[model samples]
Target: MKSLETKAKEELRKAKSDIFSLEYQNKKVWVKKARGTFSSALHKFYYKVFPFEVLIPVETKTGKETIAFETAKLDLFREKGILSPKVLFKNDEFFILEDCGKNVNSYIRKRDITQEKMYYYLNLLIVQLALIHNNGLFHGGAQARNFTYKEGVIYAIDLEDSFTNIPLEVLQFRDVLLFLLSLTKTRASFDLDYNYIIEKYIELTNKKELKQSLKKLANKISFLIYLSQIKLINSFLGRDVKGFFKLFIILKKL
Candidate 1:
């Protein structure tokens, strides 16, 4: 039997997908390939169109740079006491991460999951986000699907973004917005109290700048909420808009 590291190297040589899972040493790990040129370009294009200061996007890296960037991020988060997958192996074209567990989105979507259980995980996610912010770091992608639950711990993943010369508060503010936006994608969105989530986050961190950033963004985008009332707007986007508005309202109050 080959060692897991050797197996990973062999698998990376033939892997086609951008990401996949492998089993070795009785443990599962994820292998990720660097983003291709076209995909990297497309990602950068989207950010160019949106150019919000609080939402400033990091330049998309490709090839070996992508592997290096994410590996550094995972290490940074771990150093800051935030939970993230341990990087098992890395090279120019590919990297491997220990399987954290079921994605938080999938866990919440489980048919047997109760509302109470859902809130429990959601709260944990928020707490983790707060801790990240408090440490002066931010998750460039804070979506529910980018988080995983394992053994009573929630781990952050998909950290492919990096920033330079940006205020820490701005990055942290974007994290809060991304997290709020993600909640709208789930069935639990309708049942959740957006104000409570905002309040909980605020309670966990002393970052006054983050609260002010949310307030400023909410005021600027308040007009878009009216569009959600339009009949033609699809249910999914409408929920997201409404959820964003609710979070904004809570921020304004704070």
Candidate 2:
């Protein structure tokens, strides 16, 4: 007479042996069995700016209860009314989530995006983030890959890594900074308006400090850009100096 929870745990253990339970439309659903150590918060920032995933260690969870912990976190986001995947099923190994929609990258690839449209979508993404932070939550991974859009609404995904470990203010600002960095990847060549985006986010949240936070971040980015210009520092940091300068230019324009 095992309880339903117990049964689910048993299924999760079995799932580790056979990773993928289903697959379709180039999207594979499986329990990623290998658990690795978590990255430091600093590396999370580098992850947005650098192409060093090849050298990064896998996320190795120290215990078997990791999946359960992740499942609970996803449930909390849904309860908070944040747009994210709904848990369809769960166990200790992995949980099946309802497909929210196409991720931002896929949605943008469908056609040539006008600068106006890019700005509009970027503004919407930031607004959604404001809503999440307003609810006292922080999306640890705020890159475009972790977000999807459908029917005029944006949804966040990959809650397993989302957390509240840092202060709400720091986390909120990191989310903003990371998201802006992500847009640089997509629309690097476009003459985008960073000021409008930041202003609108501050307006939506009514957080005056957001503007200050962004200013400080812009300064730090500018420093990085200068370092990137140094040949020795550039080689040591493995930074795309041009990319750093580009991002700094965008932020400075704000």
Candidate 3:
């Protein structure tokens, strides 16, 4: 077995690859390049069953483009005094980064976090995302899985999906929606109120527009859930039904 650093360097030299992961100095790092496409068995199965292209998130840029984009994004976060990973080395094919720590999902799952602690952590994530949006940027995939906690601080990661092509308003609302959806999915039992989370985000950003957009989006999603519940539409639009009802419960509260 090669050292993690050696593997990382080797992967960077490859012409084409899908995902590369290795550990260096007791820290884990990885790269995701397009070596064809990857999807879960569930996703593939559903596509065959439905045979319709759903409007899904796309990464049009190659791994090289993503590396440069994320590198610049990291610099921007640091300049704005936000906590995130630091780039150790980068090139067109891939980049090496300082592993921040366990993602929020892993941390929460590994320990029994108190309700108070959970609220604190969630609020911190919302505020950090709010800060990023307030600075006129958006993390395309704003989920707990993309956030890390270490040494009493939360760090954002998986920024290759960050983008600025859309209007800031749309992206801001999208950021909140994506986050709440991800949060609800992680919590198998709908034990948390998403409204308070959005309220906190609105408070941090002081953006009344975000509050309005959030309400509209929540209501729209809630209606879809209603349709699914009525069998008028397929759960997850014929995709994953694992958390559809849970998401409905979440949106209703919102």
Model 1: lDDT of residue 232 = 71
Ranking by TM-score: 1, 3, 2
Clashing pairs in 2: 35-60, 35-61, 36-59, 36-60, 36-61, 37-60
**CA deviation > 4 Å runs, candidate 1:** 13-16, 36-55, 110-113, 209-211, 230-254
- In the range 51-96, model 3's lDDT, one tens digit per residue, is 4222123445655676777789888888888888887766665566
Distance (Å) between predicted and true CA of 221, model 1?
Answer: 2.3
Better of 1 and 2 by lDDT: 1
Give the alpha carbon lDDT tens digit for every residue of 1-254 in model 1: 89766887788778777888999888999998876332346556766775665356576466788788889999999988899999988878778899999899897755566778988998999999998888878888898899999999999999887776877777777788888778766755335677678778888996546666767766666666556546676365655455565566665665
TM-score per prediction, in order, is 0.83, 0.70, 0.73
Displacement of residue 64 (Cα, Å) in model 1 is: 1.0
lDDT of each: 0.78, 0.62, 0.66
Candidate 1 global lDDT: 0.78
Q: Could you list the CA RMSD of all candidates, in the order they appear? A: 3.2, 6.7, 5.9
